[model samples]
Target: MKSGVHRKLLNYFLGEDKTMKKFTLSLAFLLLCLSYLPLWAGDYRAAYEKNDFKTAFALAKPLADKGDPEAQHMLSGLYKVGWGVIKDYQLARKWMTKAASQGHKEAQSSLG
Candidate 1:
């Protein structure tokens, strides 16, 4: 048996466990949280649907800056159509290409 702790933990993500198990659980939770943190905000698309471009922009811009391709795609649309912003094809193209480089599908289609 591997007898060393290849596990880790944090205080905020505590769950039921013994000391070592608690550590491992907390670490796992932390990793999970970190992994999904870039997209943590739900209802972003929902906000867009409600024509709340300001809300959508607010929700998507930071993630877009963080290299989230989907957010980039959304930002491209916001720029293209002037949703909560001034319309600028150049800016739209810029954001679309940024997203396309990150494998965003809609960005590629828009580029076509």
Candidate 2:
């Protein structure tokens, strides 16, 4: 009886330890992925600067939808110029307004 109880306790503790290790690894991986977000944003800007509007739109659309002001501003420009999407002043104004509301200076100036 004593040996059985001890074995059960050991197994329980080992299971918990494995769970903790998994959690720690998962957290680390998540942080690593998040750390690359800025690099992706930089890629978007570089694509735009290089006149790779399609790539820039592909990159910025997601971030803009997630409410990144800079991405929203870039998306607005893309919309306004029909660079990567159909020219739609309505959509351009919509994204520009979103960026301006988030205190993007260029967006604000453009709105003015």
lDDT of 1 at 92: 85
What is the per-residue lDDT of model 2 for residues 1-112, given as tens digits with 9 covering 90 to 100?
Answer: 9998787668666785566677778999999999997787778899999999999999999999999999999999999999988899999999999999999999999989
TM-score for each model: 0.64, 0.73
Candidate 2 off by > 4 Å: 1-29
Q: After superposition, how far is residue 50 of candidate 1 from its true place, in Å?
A: 1.5
Give lDDT: candidate 2, residue 11: 66
Error of 1 at 71 (Å): 0.5
lDDT for each of the candidates? 0.81, 0.91
Q: Model 1: runs farther than 4 Å from truth?
A: 1-39
